[model samples]
Target: MPTSTRTVAEELLYRIGEGDTERIAELFADDVDWKLDWPEAEHGRPATPWIRHRSTPADAAANFRELAEHHVAEGAATEVERILIDGGDAVVLGEIRRTARPTGRAYRARFALHLTVEDGRVTRFHIYEDSLAVAQAFER
Candidate 1:
């Protein structure tokens, strides 16, 4: 049996929570439409290193690794409020809490992730989050 979109989405969340970058990358297709809701030009402050443009699975994995490197692992958490699936698309609503390693500042931000699955692999991954709060947390 082929994998369902819901299953793929659930597994994505599980892998992310486990900080398993390899498993997470396995779920994405070679060419991914990746986007994060942070516009550096409008924000004045530069985006965190992890907010760069990514298209390949390797880039996706590297992004997560870079993010993990800048955060404190001990108290990092993701509280998923709900997941809505429609055909091949899934939208995950949640709140993420993490401490910036350099500043030792914690930030909790509401987030929404939209994933589009095709042939059991995610092709589109778009994330919307409170970028201001996250940026502030990393401020020295």
Candidate 2:
């Protein structure tokens, strides 16, 4: 039997938790447009350094490195607070708790994601996160 989109989405979260960008790339379409809409908390600067509008799987994978250069998730944990699926689309409500690398500042944030799975691969992904909290954690 074919895998359900919901199952794929859940597995994607698992891959994220593992910091397995290669596996995460496999779950996206070749031409996936992945975006993280982290708001700007500083003038001309984004809250999270890895805010992305990745247009390809390789581009999406690079986001992990970019993020690591800015902040690391030590003792990070996430909970899928809710998931709703309809046909090829899914919405995930999630929360994350972690200590930032170097700084060792703790961060707790909630997020929501809208995903579109096509041909069993994610074609589109858009996530909204608590940018203010993220910015504060990285503040020096």
Per-model C-alpha lDDT, please?
0.89, 0.76
Could you give candidate 1's per-residue lDDT for residues 17-43 as a string of tens digits?
A: 888998889998999999889885543
Q: Pick the candidate with the highest lDDT.
A: 1
**Per-residue error (Å), model 1, residue 16:** 0.8
Cα RMSD to the true fold for all candidates: 2.1, 2.7
Distance from true position, residue 28, model 2, in Å?
0.7
The list of candidate 1 runs beyond 4 A from truth reads 40-47
lDDT of 2 by residue, 1-116 (tens): 12578988888888777777777778888888676765434423544546646878777677766666656655678888999999999999989786667577889889998988
TM-score list, all predictions: 0.93, 0.85
Output the worst ten-in-a-row residue range by lDDT, candidate 2. Answer: 39-48
Assess candidate 1 and give its lDDT.
0.89
Per-residue lDDT of 133 in model 1: 92
